[model samples]
Target: MVSIGLKGLRHLDQKPTLSKANRNSFTNEYWKGVRVKFIIQAAAGGISFMLLFLACSCYLYGSLYKSHQRYHNFRILAVDYDGGVIGKALSAAYEELKRPEFPTLYFHSPEDFPTPSDVYQIVRNGHYWGAIYSTKGASDRLEAGIQGGQAATVYNPNDALYWVWNQQYYTTFAQSVVEASIEQLVSAARAAYTKINGTQAFPYVAQSDPDAVQAFLNPIAATVANVEVDAQDSVFLFTSISMVMPVLQQFFFLLALNGVSREHQLYSKMSVRSSMIIRGVAGLLYTFGAALTQAGYYWAFRDGWKVDGNQFVLTWMVLWLLMHTHFTYLDAISAITPISRMPFAVLTWIFLNISTTISPLELQPGFYYWGICLPASNAYSVLVTIWSGGGDNRLYRALPIMFAWWIVGNLLSMAAHLRACHLAYKFDKEQQNNKGDGESAMGMTPVGSEVTIRPHSTNESAAHDDLQQDKTLEEQDLEQRQIYGPSIPPPFA
Candidate 1:
């Protein structure tokens, strides 16, 4: 049956010149159908693309809207251990400070955080975005050093105020908001100290106690300790492209796979299950290599970066999982989506993923919280953690999120493949049924149906074959006539 169908379609594989009558008939009878097909396709494609892109564009645009205004959502702990003149001045200044965009500081007593080092631990632990703490006896040490007249050795002004934050969390926010607020706190303390010491014998202190004068002027200098600093400058490139590179690779592979499948007629030639399995395996293999190559590239250019073997493996594993998740999801979506609309899907995927990572969720509006659930967010969280040595340690939670996405994506792809197989089977069955019915109407034998398809008698079969031969010859002659014109047909004869 397949051989017969191919033989019948052989002529359609070749281009033939059109006669005047054939052209008129095609223009009158078939052209309208073709035009209507294109029209419906254009309208549907345009409308759907516009709606999806507009919604996605709005989502990405709105994701970070008024981000600076949401700065107060970030919490920074303030521990005033210096319960003397400096601490009192800092406390009063902290109260009077009012910057709407600045993070609201939560002040705690020195008793809450016994040692100044505890502030670094809490900040690195992700308890708060940052911490502003003063050391014990910051004021007393300064006062004693001032009175002794040779107290420069005992008094380190930078030790008076310490701001602890992790730059690895989000460098922009860490520097702009968290550090900015810390600077303001330090400035407030400075103003308050000058107010307290204005009446003192400044000339006497300046001459006899040069150290005290220096301490008095710069009493509340800040000691910034960025616990989770980036490993190297190249790390910025490594993490920034983490989302884009995988997605681009996935898109390119899917497109290439689709093109190959269409050219080879894989879907029509192979069973649906077999083809889908091949595609799935191919995607996994490609992602594996891609992940390895990407990891190798980073390793090659580490530029003094270092990590344990386990961490290195985990980084590669995260990349593999992330790429796999992206591939399976795209494969499933592409199975149902038209090729023309795929560009829009890819763009939407990339933009939505980047919108979440470009800034921290705490800085963005609440609606962007779902961004954390996305694969890019989790994968990036794990990657940055690996690169920065130790960040918020979201790996405990992010790894599982990526794994879940990979599992769900594979399931969806499998289901879509099954649906495709079912649809293909139905289409083949309908074509066979229609062929049997048409042949029966022509009083000829029909092969392929188990029941109700009439087979012609011997005489009827012979007559039908002769008639088909005659029709074939007639078509050949007509096509030649159309190509060469009636007057030039002598050459063929």
Candidate 2:
């Protein structure tokens, strides 16, 4: 056994371990040069990456956080067709409820009574959270009901219905507040009428009683309906996840593209097909990994695993394909214009995060609403439809937009890659021709003619020496490929 152990030790000594080989590579003079180049490249890339990361982080987190903090900054439109005591009372009630310090709804009354179609258009445009319509007979109807011991018809859809543009996120909170305020206003009006007339507007009765007086005193009612958009459950969680998921996905894609681009630059002699295959494989892995991670996160925290299996699977597949196509485009962009990676990354981050995924697209200005058609925005719509159930039509609509992005991004990326490869090949061939010409001239000089050695004047020699130094600097530059690589031009240059 000791002899065998000694032989094993000798064999181990003869064979270099991976760590030893790595250590030697680091210390080796040729590898030291490579290491230095790598560090320089890494440093340049790192600084640009850090700048872009900080910008994206600041914009995303800062804007989202601030919006959350200031969620109360919403305006509501109130139309008083009643033009009577009760109309003024309801408007005053809403006005009184407005508190600047908290999330409060500000109610604005138009100078003239707006038609129902006008109200709908205004709300649809998302200028206000909702609009309240009070009919001319609202006060008279309540008074007649109170006097005749009958239920008041206060919330007629033709007269006094509150049409709320129900978005799942901001509208829920705003709706609750509006409903509560209307109830309070009605109660106060009933109490005032009773005090002046010396009688109770509503008197409690047995369980079997129709409770006409109670209805009269609390006549204000609301019908909450979603229009042009679907209501979402768990609004806060859904919105937060929508923002975070895209940021994480884009970050992973940037890393994958950057790595693949560096690999291509270092192995410039790699066949184009092989390089594309490697990038495609890397993008696939990244997309799959990111999709799994996002899905797992949703499952663990958002009860996604308990969701309908088919819907969950479909959502996951959609997310995966979206990321795969997006990353593939990024990989091609990296290959074509590596220096533009940072700018493109920042632009994409802004587009995904600032778009309508986390909020109502209608709430944004008209110009920004166009961004709702972007792939990220459409993806969020599909995600919400799948997660919350229903809205098959929305999912269907979003599908075409997603497909368009996938197709367009891939096509543009491929074209750019082909162009870049052609340029690189042309550059390489020109370099080879220049080198061959220099070699041929040197070889033919002695064979074709007697070579004369000429002595230069001091000024001429100085100029020649300077030219030699410039040539050495150019050679050194050619040896060191900057982070942009030889093929890619510097950004904005």
Candidate 3:
């Protein structure tokens, strides 16, 4: 009852209308200095921070995984079971496999057989992805039925151990050698049969019956003709850069907004002030634009690194516009919480933690899509298109989805920011009156008046001001005590 009565009397303590107008004029004068200072400070700090981030990013990505490249030469060991003739044939076949650039090859005679377990262990420990083993069972089968015998047996490590690049060529070369051997044996058998009979022997069917030949050859031909590997090498790097760049950019926006929310907390009436609103929006846009420009420049100059530059640029622009707008909306949510900074900081950290999988757009789609929906996901998509030779069609298809997400996220954020701003200001006069004073006729410094408005930035004075609001309340107490006989009684007490 006493607090309510005091609150009722507090409004009667407001400054008269004429003095209020004069104070307004003074406040305008005070803020001209404030605006000029803030504009300079914000512009300087924003540019400095952006450049530093860009420089660091460029240094990190410029080499593009050069450290993992394998330059040391290595050798492959081959074991031959056949005598000199078969051995020579095997050697020729091995050499053929090694052609177009041999790493190194060492041939071992058949008698020096390593046990199967030892062979497996050696291959595993030897850093060798390839090895071939022949067995006597294959030779005996061939001798028993020269024209219809099983081909020589060769054992290899698990398919996972196969060298990705050499798998197809190696298979083709091995089949060709088997066919040549079969043909030689069959020809010798036909000659021997004719020599014994003194004329031609009964006709034997060929392995290349037309129907069988077509069934085997047709699909293989189509597969080779239709399957394409039209990938550029730099797609991986470009996608990587894209995935990480958005995360860095969003982090800057989140932190900067946290600072803005702090400023609003410092002065209550400033929430509804049009100037504050404009500056808040403008500052956010400026930072967002700066980050976007840096990302775009990196994208454009990426050179033959990625294709579809213009498409990527368009997609990215629409996507970021949505993202920054959504961030503006989220500003309110951050401000209303007791510790607004913590949520944004933690969320940004979480997004970054999950962003690694999509860090490069050029990765195979199977891997890229796994974690691509994270903040870096869209950026990775745009980058992959550029790196993998996509263009306008892909951008047109993708940007709408990104734009929709951006819109939805911003809408939620904006609603929260606006409501929080309103609530923060609503308690301004109440909080002020609750201090050691009844209330000033002027009401919490009328925001811009008497308040030394700095640039909407956090500097030493601002930090000090944050902890120093009691001085403003002190002045109000002195004025109230002089006029009202000190009945104010420390409003809380």
Candidate 4:
């Protein structure tokens, strides 16, 4: 409440009002400062964008640059049980093709693996990318067939070369690169075999047994079996950088979470821990819905692109964990990173994480080896395993990394949230203190002719003059009410 003596009340009606020109004496100076600041900010923005472009190029392109140079990282085991010509030829053929860009085939004796099932286990267990094996008596069967007798009628050509690989492990890569390379390998091996046997078999090539004739012609018919068929070309989008799209969408979710908290002053009203918990719980719930939506796309698009799933529940769980990993980490970033700079931070994070997942770790440079530890890469590994029906089964390996990201992101976010809360509480207290000071000062400070103003952002001192003016009329009304009866409020009015 403002109190005014009779003398002050009489003079209040006579107070002077400043003209528009006089109201802001330094308008030119303020506008000039704004213009200068705008120019500086514009220059800074251009430079920042240029830097971001350069930095993100390295993040996005690092793995892709000379990607094939590291392809020897894919290990293939070559085992020969036949211990004969075709096996020797295939081994030699594989060696001839063993460039740095191609998967290297390590030759192993039949003694190393008890049976073909052992090779299958090696492939399935992902100890190696694939295996080339000649079954027992492969050369013997082909030899008997070539000789042309009773053996010629019943001889099987497929018994020669068998390729054990799970195309489901990386369908696109297998089809485009691995399969093509395998075809070349088989062709070369066949040619090598024909060169050696063509002269010997030509005289006996007149055999009437069609099965044996076919076997003699193409003795090594390499058959590749997909341990689990994952031929879907559409999974590329879900496997690559596109997979992180939904994760990137969480920036807006974070913005919305912040908008409400800021507008409603939710953080200011609650204890620090409670406010952060609300944010976490809200983010988790939102991520749950997002995960379901992603999983639904995986299901809904099955017929269109096909990643057949009885794995819906597991898919949803993976998506939930994956998206939440992004959310919690981004939330922590936003806690420290200003909203204006968050786009850069987000872009950099997305590019960095997605780069690690673009190709097989072997195809990427060693510098990117550690990137597999990134949450997005780990999430992708797990998702691919799920999509392939556990083909490349990196589940146990990737889960721990994803969990580690969650733990670190939450811990960092909690610390940042506490700091932010402390600052907010401190600011609120300062505002309350300043408000009390302003109210106290006004009661003693002379107004109108003797008033003084100071420009301080947090202090409300500049508004004291306007506040005093508003109180003038209220003070007059109070004086009249005290002096007159309620019915005879004013003299004639």
**What are the per-residue Cα lDDT tens digits for candidate 3 across 1-493?**
2243555665643535434545654247677778878888889878866765565444334322332121112334445443322233334544444432233445565555454333334443323323443333332332322222222122111210111111111122212332232233223323332343212112321233443222212111000110112233343443345444544555456555444444444334554456346645764676467556755765656554333557556555644653464354344344444341333343444344234332232212333344434444544445434433342124554456567656666566555555645555555565655452423312334555776434545345544554465446666544322211112122222
lDDT of 2 by residue, 156-224 (tens): 322334445534324344445434444454444434434443243344322233344444445454444
Off by over 4 Å in 1: 1-52, 197-206, 231-241, 263-276, 300-310, 428-493
Residue 279, candidate 4: alpha-carbon lDDT: 84
lDDT of model 3 at residue 158? 20
- Cα lDDT, model 4, residue 281: 93
- For 1-493, candidate 1 gives per-residue lDDT tens digits of 2233556575543434433533555357668778778788989989988898888878877877887788888898988787777777777777777565768888898678888788778887777898887778887777766554557646888888888887767666677788788788789888878787545625435445677767766667878887766555665554356568898898778767765654454555688778878888899899999998888887877665655677778778889999999988887777676545567777888878877777788877877898898898888788767755675678778889989999999999888667655654554465456556546556565466455434567546755765554435465444322211121111222
* Model 4 clashing residue pairs (backbone): none
Candidate 2 positional error at 461, Å: 11
Minimal lDDT window, size 10, model 1: 483-492
CA lDDT scores, all candidates in order:
0.73, 0.54, 0.40, 0.73
- Per-candidate TM vs. native? 0.75, 0.52, 0.37, 0.80
What shift in Å separates residue 22 of candidate 3 from its native position after superposition? Answer: 50
| Model 4 error, position 473 (Å) | 28
The segments of candidate 4 whose C-alpha lies over 4 angstroms from its true place after superposition are: 1-37, 207-212, 304-310, 437-493
Model 2 per-residue lDDT at 101: 26
The residue-by-residue lDDT of candidate 4 on 334-359, one tens digit each, is 76665557678888888887887777
